[model samples]
Target chain A: MTAVSIDSAPKTAARRRERLASGRTYISAALIFIWCLIPFYWMIVTAFRDVGYTFDSTPFFTHVTWDNFNTVFSESLGNHFGRNLLNSLFVAGVTTVVALLFGVFAAYALSRLEFRFKFLVLGFVLGASMFPGVALVTPLFQLFTNIGWYGTYQALIIPNISFVLPLTVYTLTSFFREMPWELEESARIDGCTQGQAFRKVIMPLAAPAVFTTAILAFIASWNEFLIASQLSNDQTKTVTVAIAYFAGAQAHQEPYTAVMAAGTVVTIPLVILVLIFQRKIVAGLTAGAVK
Target chain B: MSTLAQPKRAPETPSPKTKKVQKEVGQDRAATSQGRWAFWLISPALVLLAVVIVYPVVNAIIMAFQKDQGLDPVTKVFVQGGPAGFDNFVHWLAQQCGSAACAPGTLGAQFWSAVGTTFFFTVVTVVLETVLGFWMAVIMARTFRGRSALRAAVLVPWAIPTAVTAKLWFFIFAFDGIANKLFGTAILWTGSEWPARWAIIISDVWKTTPFMALLILAGLQIIPAEVYEAAKVDGASAWQRFTQITLPLVKPALMVAVLFRVLDALRMYDLPAIMTQGSNGTTTLSILVVDQIRQGFNSAAALSTITFLIIFLVAFIFVRFLGANAVASATPKTTKGQEK
Candidate 1:
């Protein structure tokens, strides 16, 4: 009985040491996690806390309430805010699909086809990608105005296409170049039309890359504040612009919590998108700006 | 940030009918046709760029040379003006008795000062970010428990949407907000000029320092352990190894990181727009351009061109000094090399 107890006790001691080491890692991780979460935490807390409590200069603990969120959901501001979110989603969704079509086809051609002036075209597009987007905003506003497309989806859609296309094409082109050729050739030999082969074979292989491209394009379109602000006057304002306008038009910044609540609303899909495809996204992001 | 972007190594997809292309080439040595099927395929994108990017950019350049005759850009009608060559330049130079917003030396009152402030903000933020990013990267690159968590933790700030981030910072820096509470009394973080610039810079740094680290980490992952081991055996201090060894080896990625951050910083819009709304000395080139356009000035086109030139010059200096290689050789070629 003593022997068994001694053996079990030593095992427990070793387990205790292991537990201590793990505890250290957990505590360190928790600390880092808290630091990471502070902004998000404060955002949520401020979003929920009453306006009076938000400004309370007390050194410590404040009780929470969902008054702001409740107010947001039960008001005209909430209704407009919700509509704008939908507008951003719809605009972003359409923009992504269109950008993919342009970027992917261009990538396919650049990657596979032997064309004259190819290098010049490549250089021009790549150079254009680096051109400050802000510089183009003025000209675009003019162009959109000229086309009688002001305050419309056509205004945001076309420019969004241009902005996201270079990156999309650049990325997809590189991804397409890296793909093995045999799958394409074999399918070609098996009587698959180039389009069908692409649709069936190349596209499936490129699906992961496509997802990365689409997600980014969507996010860029959604977060686009400058263009959305300038071009969309009322009917077509995106959520970001709408929220900013909402903040600005306030008698005071009365909707501080509401603005953040709106941000939380806008952030949901993005956070989900980031979390779900974190690995693919990590590679895309790290490598994206490099090229 | 990964959600924001990823490298698309231009797909080098081999032609499916290379034999056909080769045969067609040899058969038609005196080719008269406009390129090939590939050109046709890429034309839609080519056309989009041609109109949206190429046409506007080329137009901006032409407009810069032409006199700004207070005309409608869309209608091309001179509502209140005539061609006055070098007058716009002189006006911008503040040589022709202009307002303080167009003043020569003092910042808060001149166009030249606005330009200076833009450069100043870009330099300070980029320099600070690089230093902080490198420090964070060095910590991350070391082998330790919870490294992945640490990496992800750093990435969270970067992943938050810019509008959300800007607004969050706005709240934090708001009068009677957390910033004021912490500093005691309501500090005007954004309402004024220099304070507003600082506030914008602070918010920008918080959001983007992680981006700088991620880029540098890509560089750090490529450094072979043997080099570090050798340095350690030679009893090199951390600073020596960092300066003499790490910096030199990772110079390429570092440059790319800096170049990207600089170009990005030059186009400061969102943070400043929200933080100060172009008030005070925080009026950047972008905000200035936006204002001119919003004012319905034909000169706005000319102004955008000038901004483009400034941005291009900055980009050129970065490219020239940084080796201009987009293909990051600092990325270790093998999977095993990813282990730090």
Candidate 2:
């Protein structure tokens, strides 16, 4: 009885320690969740609150209303929030499509075909990715002004493609490299040309990777602000620039509540995309970093 | 019968040799075609990059040397200035104007302070992010209920646009806002220097720590569970196991995350720009560059070139000494068809 008691005592102690540890884990997890989500929560709460309650000291939700959201879409004070949303969509969409088209071919060649200066190509891509956007601002601003392309969708889309291509190429290249070469070889052996094999066999298999790349590229181009802020004018402004310069109904007052509403409107779609594709996004992100 | 068989075998051997030559020739043709296809495939991206990145970079450098188009100090008429060798560089680097030190509040005088502020933000935020991210990564790596939910929640901030992030926090940090209400302190977060810096740091840390965590979590997931089991069986404490096993193993991912965050923080503009408008001593190098661009284009060019060099230098140091393997990490490990 004593021996059994002694053995069981330690096991119970260990189990108790584990339970305590798990409890601690739960507490920390909750803390992390709060830390991550509080600002977003604050934004949502303020978005729905009446503009009169903008300075209300209450921490939790109160004075819920749809007025601020209305303000976001309303044409009052020359605010073009609705139009800016469409502009952002158009720019991000076209940038994604074009970048994906160019990136797929480049990534394929970089990963599959043996060639000299492959690393040089990769180096250029990486270097361009790391190049400071601010450095390009003055030159691009001048160049766009010279060519009369300033504040156009093309102006936004062209630079966005350059910035996003690196990410697309890197993610797709890593993915394409890991794909099973035997499938392509078998297709070739079955009287398929190389292009035909890539099109029929490899592309269908590559759809998921391509989708991941597209989502990432779209998100990136959507979030771009530095160049867009300078290059975009009133008509061509993106959601980000629009929010930055959002006008209040009054001349002097800052539109805090209205801006929060705009912020929520802009963030919700991205947050939804992220939540839905959380696993794929994580996979795509780490593919470049942790490979 | 033996002689006839010998002649037949010789004919067959030569035919085999001829087939070998044909196969080699076919392989050469295939290789050339692949190369041609690759060149065509990659040129479009290359051309776009050249036009966008390469040309702008070269132009920025050239503009750094040429003076901004403005009125000559002596002549009242606005005239396009000529080459001003080393003048733009001196304006920022030496903080000198003509023969005297630039006055305070001038953009030239802000160069060193911007550099200092940029480095400060980079170091402080990265350190905070690494520690917090490591902790979060450890938690996320564990098997638990609602893990997926936690991961999705963590991504909320990261998914938010930086401009929006700036606005979201701007509301929070406002006077009589939730932050003040919760803390019961009415400190002006954006109206002062240190508080403004902390506000930027806090917002940055909140936004990017998840990124660091995700990267570190990937590294942690790659660790074998048996390693921890073995350590436990050998009576290693949790702390010891973490320091001895997990820390060393996670270093590669951790370093990469830190390097990226550092480089990112160095060029930080949006957060501070929107939050404080780069006032109250929150002027980062990029902010300073933009500010200078408004008043003096040539000097801003020089400032940006300097900024680029600084970032390049840091990246070089990281790759050279710290073994960050930035390039290798981006490259694929396996080539064609030796898949295990």
Candidate 3:
């Protein structure tokens, strides 16, 4: 029994040492995870805390309530948060759909066709997206005004589509290029016409890329504050813009908690999207630089 | 081979009644039709881009040369008059340099300060983000427990909207908020010059470092495990293996990511505008351009052109010197058909 105990003691010590090393790794990992997450946690805790308690020294949930969320949704100063939500939905939705529709066509050609100046076309689209968007605001603002589109939904939708189309095209083109030749050829051999082959064979294959591009484009348009701020009025303001301009229901109050609640509302959808489509988001994000 | 290419037969020659020739003809027809289909498929996007993006950009460039007429009596909006012959450019430069004693409210002082602020923010944020992001990427690339959850933690900040991020940090940097509480000092992060600048920079870093890490992680993933294994077997230390094998392979992706972040940082607006309202010495080029829109289109156009040229030049250098497209195309190749 003494020999067996002696043998196991050192083994246990070795095991303990290994555990300590791994525990150190876990500690560092936990630090990074906490560093990344604290702001989000604070955002939620402040979002749920009673309004007056937001400025407290301790950054903990003491007086938790749903009052801030209720205030964000309820009417205040003639700016309806619910209406802003719908406006954001409409703008982001229309922008995503239109960009996808146009982008798919361009992406398909860019990927599969051996056209003249193919590289030039790709380069041009990429360069357009990189053009400082704010630089265009001067001209776009002027043009929108001349056409009487200022404070209108089209004002936001048009520019958002223009800016986001290049991203969609780039991502989807990369995806489409990776599609194997055999898939399309087989569809052709099955007596399907080119259009039918596209509809039946290519469309299904393209769906995930399309979905990824859509989410990306949607988030971009949804998160857009510059153009929306410049173009939209109270009636047509997007959630991002509205939240930026959020004021207290009563005078002289900062409406800090309500703003946090609004921020949470806007952020929840994106967080859920990143969680659900984490792989696709990573793939789409690193599409240009990683491969 | 029979299906891909058609055999060309002279009309004068005797008809070759073979299966191969028939298939070749089918292939020829298919090839021509495919090209036509491609053209049709691409035209809509090209047309839309031409009208929406290309046209306005050209118009803006042209408008830069013109003079701004104050509000049109009939239209009540500013109007573009005849060409000003570099008047706007001269006026813009003059504002920045002509008189050292110019009023703080003058456009020139504001312009130069904004230039300085933008440069500072870009350099500091890009440097910090690259270093921090590279570190995070190294951690992410390591095989570990709960790696995915850690990746998600990093991504959470990135997934949230920039405006929300700005607001989140704005509260944190408030005089009576968490930053002060944690540090045991009241820094007035958004109400002072350097403190406000740091606030903007820190918030930007927090939001975008994940993006940098994600890109770098992609670069790291493409480096094969066998290379490191071989290096270790050869008695190379971890540091040596990393410097020799990993750094060289990841350089292209790193350069592309940095250039992308640089371009993005130059156009930064949402964060600073939200965090400090461009007060406290945080007005960037974007904020200046937007601010000048109310004054006149001509000056703003000239400013816009300058900004565009700067961005274009940076992109040109990246593409020409570093071969950004080469590295860009590399990422997709590694990921090919994996999504399927």
Candidate 4:
């Protein structure tokens, strides 16, 4: 009886400790969730709040209205929210398409083909990825001005492609290298040419990887602001630049509510997309970071 | 009959061997052709890179040496100035105009302070993110219910645009915002000096800690569960297991994450640009470069070149001295005998 009591006492203690550790984990998890999300919650709450109640002290929802979102869309208020969204879509779309188009072929070669200077090419891509946008701003500004290409979609798309291409190539190369080449070999044995084998067997298998790369590249291009801010004219300004320069109804007011609405408008779609593709996005991100 | 069968079998064996050689020769030829295809495949990206990245970098360096096309103070007229040897560099590095030190509020005068501010933000933000992210990663890495939900929640901040992040935090730091209410003191968050810097740090930490956590979580997942079980069997405490096993194993991912965060914090512009407009001593090197560009293009070029050199130097140090293994991790491990 004494032995049983002693053993049971320690076991209960261990169980209690386990329960306490789990409780702590949940508490910290809750804290982290709030810490990450409070800013977003504030943004959304303010976005829906009436313009006059921008400073409403209540932490919870109050004076909810759509007026702020309306103000964001109202052009007479000097807010180009709609036009800016369209511009963002156009630039990011074209950039993604072009980067993927070039990136897929380059990645395939880097992964599947036996080539000289392969690592050199990979190194170049990595280096370009790390090149500072500020460094390129002045020269690209001047060059675009000289070529009469400033404020053009091509101006934004071209530079964005250069930036996003490295990410696309790197991610896709790793994905391709992991693919089974035996299928391609069998296709070749069955009388398919190299290109045919790539198209029929390899590309179909590569679709998921391509999709992941596209999402990342698109998001990156969409969020680009540095060179965009310098190179874009009023007509071609992106949503980010538009939000940065968001104006008030009158000259002196802050336009806080309307800006929040604009921020919400731009962010909600991305947030939803990320939540949906969370796994794939995480895979793409960590693919280059870990072996 | 035995002799005849032996001769026939010997010929059959050599035929199979000869076929294998022929196949190898064919593969070698296909490899060369594929190499040529690779050259063509990559040239388009290489050319675009040259035009967009390479040429511009070269142009920036050249522009850094050339004088700005502006009024000569004595002449008081616009002059497309000719080459100026180290004048642009000296203007920034020495904080001088001609010979004397630049007066306060001049673009040149802010150079060193911007450098300092950049380094300050880099160090503070990277360190905070690494610590917070590691903790977050440890929690997320544990086998718990709602783990996926936690991960998805964490990604929200990372997915939001940097510009939007700046604006979101801007509203939070407003004079009559929730931050003031929560703290119960009306400290001017974005208006004052230290508060403004801290505001940037807090928002930056919030935005990027998820990235660090995610990277570290990937590292943590790769650590075999057997390792912990074995350590447990040896009576290792949680702290001992974490430091001795988890920390060392996660170091590579941690280093890479920190390297990226440091480089990113160094070039921080959008946050400060929108939040405070680089007022009250928050101008980073990128902001300084952008501000200088508005006044003098050549000087901005010089400043940006300097910024480039600094970032490049940091990357070199991280890759060379630190055990980040950035390039090796980025590339695939299997390179030989796998391709047809």
Q: Which stretches of candidate 2 lie over 4 Å from their true place?
A: A1-6, B1-31, B73-79, B334-340
| A106-182 per-residue lDDT for model 1 (tens digits) | 87776665445566566566666667766677777877788888888877777777678877777776666557767
* DockQ winner between candidates 3 and 4: 4
Lowest-lDDT window of 10 residues in candidate 4 chain A? A1-10
Ranking by TM-score: 4, 2, 3, 1
List ranges where model 1 is wrong by over 4 Å.
A1-36, A57-62, A70-79, A111-119, A177-182, A185-197, A247-250, A288-291, B1-37, B61-79, B95-109, B183-186, B230-237, B327-340
Expressed as tens digits, the lDDT of each residue in A115-150 for candidate 3 is 445666776788767768777788989998999988
Question: Candidate 2 residues B20-55, lDDT tens each?
Answer: 776666567666777798999999988878887888
Q: What DockQ number belongs to candidate 1?
A: 0.31
TM-score of each: 0.81, 0.93, 0.89, 0.93
**What's the DockQ of model 2?**
0.54
Give the true-contact fraction for every prediction, in order. Answer: 0.41, 0.68, 0.64, 0.68
> DockQ: which is higher, 2 or 3?
2
B-chain TM-scores per prediction: 0.77, 0.88, 0.83, 0.90
Which segments of model 3 are wrong by more than 4 Å? A1-24, B1-34, B71-80, B96-102, B326-340
lDDT of 2 by residue, A170-256 (tens): 888878876887788778768788799999999999999999999999999999898899888888999998888788877787788
Residue B276: error of model 2 in Å?
0.6
DockQ pick, better of 1 and 4: 4
